[model samples]
Target: METSHDDDSLVNFADDQDDDLDIAPNPDRFRDAVLYGTDWTVRTLLQQIEQGNIDLSPNFQRRDAWSSRNKARFIESVALQLPIPQIVLAERKEQRGTYIVLDGKQRLLTLAQFAGGFSNDHSLWSESAKVGPLRLSGLKVLPDLNGKTYQDVVDRAELGQFRTQFDNHTIRSALIRNWPDEDYLYEVFIRLNTGSARLSPQELRQAMKPGPFTEFLSVRSGDSSVLQKILGLTAPDFRMRDVDLLLRLIAFQTRLPRYKGNLKPFLDDTQRHLNASWSDEQNNVVALVDRIEDGLEFLIKCFGSPREVGRRWDDKRFDGPINRAVLDVQIASAFDPNVRRAVASGALDLRAAYIDLSESDLDFGQAISVTTKSITAIRCRYQSWQRALEKAVGASIQMPVLPNA
Candidate 1:
């Protein structure tokens, strides 16, 4: 399932230095792996899916796979016996019979979704969501088949007396097994999805770095309704844009000591370590995330509405729309001890104090808006916050010192 970019409500900046970064293939090394082609009739493929042979979970899909119109056109081509594009899959190393999709996940899902009644626990990203039958529409080549279900097509061909080409056509597929690691397969996806469905940095990071920490991040990001509301997300971003922002928060809150101005490598380094030590570190990780969530909720209280979370003042008044730069500093402040005390105690008139500081502190004002990737900008936010929070709470709030600070 592919998601449109409009869902990302946060403002975009040219920081993070990640737009052009990628893990290039190791040039000095070569490895051998087995690759072969296979055929699958729709019925057989559905059977495999029902039997849990294929993985089409949120992690496996490109999210919302494709639009209904695109799916209908593809189904029409199948009905016309046109040569469809090849699908690619990788045979699981431990469980050879089970497979994970390297490419063509949506095509396979489309087949299952159109078939109707196809149910698998992990098929779709959502737990309650299932692959129900789709009514074919917008069929250009096969206008006659439009609005027909799979069974409708079958029954029209013959109510037990005839058969349709759709019921028996075989899809071309290639299966690669004995890959060196899952990372290699993810790289395969990076190469395969270079067209209209290129992977975002967060998406690529998710693929390239697979671990319990990443899995934990995925689960929490999808399940946290409060977090979703803060980000104006009713559901998880199919493109993992919501997840991207959450990752930034997690990195800043938990690993500010390791930040080196470049967010991309800093996040990558932190995730790699936490992922490897998740078993021993999970409890602490959960606690940190809870604190971060606490900070998020506290901010909402200050603004009086979740929708106003990332909102800041414009030149004249506090009328600017929600943006990512505001979120960056706000999230970074979540771990401050004084803020935590305010969060725990429900400190009074904190909203007034917050607005006052934002209005009076010119440096904090500028830091929350432009060229905010530098140590000066970040330190200004935390340092200025110490004064505001100390005044509001009537106590000393130890500032969270960053590496370059």
Candidate 2:
């Protein structure tokens, strides 16, 4: 739960989140994805995990919610022969019976972590996720088992009687055999996860849209100094808001004219098309990333900080929370080669112009705050900023040419 001091980066960003998961649901994909129910004994499940047959959606595993104590409690639940929730997985067509865990990742991981016995290397999930071997504590019903590790259970030192009992226990599992490409998986993944648990917008997108491009976004979003500075982030957002921010920048850079008010669908379409053609567009995508980076560096130089364009001001310091509208415009505008060049050398200080508008311009304020995701508002923000840039540079800034749709 590493958090940002910036209110908008973590709290406000997550509170507002995105448009909706079902905004672009496809009924066709719903019927196409298939699931079958089965049960696996504790021994077999651990074996499968050890063999690396059970994958934990590596792409979308950027955020983790389970605590060690919670994991220990779940392990205790198994030891007590209490019924645990069913696991859900997607059977890989490439390898029959081998699976990618869609749900119950924590349970499987906990089981693997505990059952690794003495060596952490034997705990497949723990070793892969870099978690240590489980050491149980704080058992309400099983105080006798407190402070015991899996090695203790195996060594016949104490609590050995219950290990065989634990091994014999079975857990229910559902295997999805078929999942055609679409957003339906997002709905099922959300529904199956249950109980106020929702993946952040970009987290869900990685699950729904898996491709080299999506992976590219995930990597680029992590460990970014420029991003950390701009979002006021102490660390990359666990909610994948940082990842979503990169996707938004890419979307608006290439498809701004096509964005008709709805940000969710606009970004969705962009991901879908780009992912399908990522092989051909990899070079172009790299260039786009460079453009955004250069533009941001220039903006930082002009404004004295990235926050100038992204964060709102309260007459003095840049204390106001992030306005997504302003950030997007600033980022999208930076996509232009011409704009970046002008911004880098122009006599006009973008920070001053932005502050002037922020304090005095009613229209800009409304554009940023009211129906901010609306097409009207988005274009209004861009046009207003463009006017300021052009006025400062004494020339019209041409928009970057985009690839054919």
Candidate 3:
């Protein structure tokens, strides 16, 4: 990392570190050294901003998240030749010769807007509307300047002085297109922005260089209203952490036969595989989703029924085994060939099966509890059910009848 901490340029805006004040002349520290003279021009910077090439990572705050007054003040300060803080840029490997914004995002954006002529009506700027050409002639001098005011300075210019002044007042220093290495840039981004609201790793992942899977999830999270509805019903106050868990579970379910503890590396591997597979991976995802949905449906059908018992059976009623049996049904549905076939055939009536089982006075909960005896009983029952289903399906025969038969 190439860090520039020139004490001479450091501006101590206030003595109180505890005060809620933004530090001035925040030095541009680069962890990675970059080849100089490889920098971009003002026009190029504006073009990148317009093209959305300049991605603001979690380390960078949102555009216009700063107040309009602060933005206007910043613009005014720049127009009057006042010092603005240096911008921090991290070289990203994924972007390939491009940089990610760390600090000074707001100031850089404000300058870009001015250069692009996007500061017409202050309200338009307030709304972050990128319109109108910047009227360089309208730029005023600092009101608190000790020297001549802006109008006085500009008015007293000779015939060709205006063009010369405009030409000389360059605004190209704000762009940081050169960085030596990614680590240096990342360290600077972390340390310099320590006191500020820090970005979580997930957020950083999204901002810096998100892979296709992350982008896909973001798009799906917004596009699939049905999924959101289902999620809200299941977990209303769902957080990003919970979303990560869901991702892990989905990965585990989809990539059966292989299980790993670490989700990050697993997700990374999955993304690489997905990228390599491209269209085929998408097909697999669709298939996996369908299977999971079918499994859930089977669970609901086999367990969602109320039962009443007479005086003799009432005292011996069991709910624990019943619930465990329901869960077991769900687990079995995931791996059962018969269940897969039933779903594929679309001929099995799960509701009827559920109703019939509900009337059978079975102590399902006790049959699948944590105890060894319960587990043994549950396993035996599962094996019996598997064998009976296999026989019913005529697994050894050349042909088998559908479930309705």
| TM-score for each of the candidates | 0.67, 0.70, 0.38
Q: What shift in Å separates residue 342 of candidate 3 from its native position after superposition? A: 24
State which candidate, 2 or 3, has the greater TM-score: 2
Candidate 3 local distance difference test against the native: 0.40
Model 2, 154-255: lDDT tens digits are: 887556768877887889988887777434555666666455434445655665566788878877777666876776666666567778878888887777
lDDT string, candidate 3, 2-97, tens digits = 111122221111111211212233335343355233334445565655555666322122213334445456546654455445555555665664
Give, for candidate 2, the lowest lDDT window spanning 10 residues: 1-10
Worst lDDT 10-window in candidate 1 = 11-20
Off by over 4 Å in 2: 1-9, 12-18, 21-54, 59-152, 155-157, 162-199, 232-236, 297-309, 313-321, 333-346, 398-405
Deviation in Å, model 3, residue 319 alpha carbon: 32
Rank ordering of all candidates by TM-score, starting from the highest: 2, 1, 3
Whole-model Cα lDDT of every candidate shown, in order: 0.67, 0.68, 0.40
True lDDT of residue 69, candidate 1 = 84
TM-score of 3: 0.38
- For each candidate in turn, give its C-alpha RMSD to the true structure in angstroms: 5.8, 5.5, 16.7
In model 2, how many backbone clashes occur? 1
